[model samples]
Target: MKEMQTFLKKYHEEMNWEISNESYEKTRASLLNNYMLLTTEVAEVAEELRKAFNFTHSHILNGMKDSEAFDLAKENAKEDLGKEFADCLAYMIKFANYFEIDLEESFYKKMDEVKNRKNRDVSLSRK
Candidate 1:
């Protein structure tokens, strides 16, 4: 992913697309779409909360209901958010391709940088 970002950055510089790199544009688009999905998730959670706490004035009860709402939120994450997540990845790859990225060379260079890095420990920590 980082390799792709780097390539996109280079492409943008070479093409002089100064507002944003292609990769960042894709990411921003993904984030915007993801935000829409998040709002829906919030709405779902709020509806669940209303159902679970329509009679509850107790703080503890409300908290538990909210927890249950979040459990439902987790389900929403797996379903709707998951779809958006996949779409984001696809868009990123498409962006890379659109910029005529040589992913193989980019990936190899990234690997080389990783291997040669002084902060080898930090690279290991990434995964």
Candidate 2:
């Protein structure tokens, strides 16, 4: 995660896409614009899931078993889904880099905190 963040930081700099630090207003606008873009990428990820679900439904309508149909749909969607995920990660990394955040460390810390939380939600079902 650290390596990925560093690479993206360099890549953004090379592309002149780094968040602006020219002035307060410019930085705010840049951050807002990036946030909007990140949300759009998240929506695209949802679209990919929708497409996969539709494909699975279509296959089921044609008499395929639900599990088999879903497997095929998942395989078909895998590449595009991965791309969408990568897009989301890039934006997230950009923000993390801008703030000099250690994402890998933060992720582990957050997971530990969640694990030790006293008010954690109880599971309603087990698979």
> Each prediction's Cα lDDT score?
0.57, 0.95
Q: Which stretches of model 1 miss by more than 4 angstroms?
A: 1-61, 65-69, 102-127
For residue 1, model 2's alpha carbon misses the true position, in angstroms, by 0.9
User: For this target, which candidate reaches the highest lDDT against the unseen true structure?
Assistant: 2
What is the lDDT, from 0 to 100, of the residue 95 in candidate 1? 54
Q: Local error of candidate 2 at 113, Å? A: 0.9
The best candidate by TM-score is 2
Q: Write down the RMSD of all candidates, one decimal each.
A: 11.5, 0.9
TM-score of each: 0.33, 0.96
Off by over 4 Å in 2: none
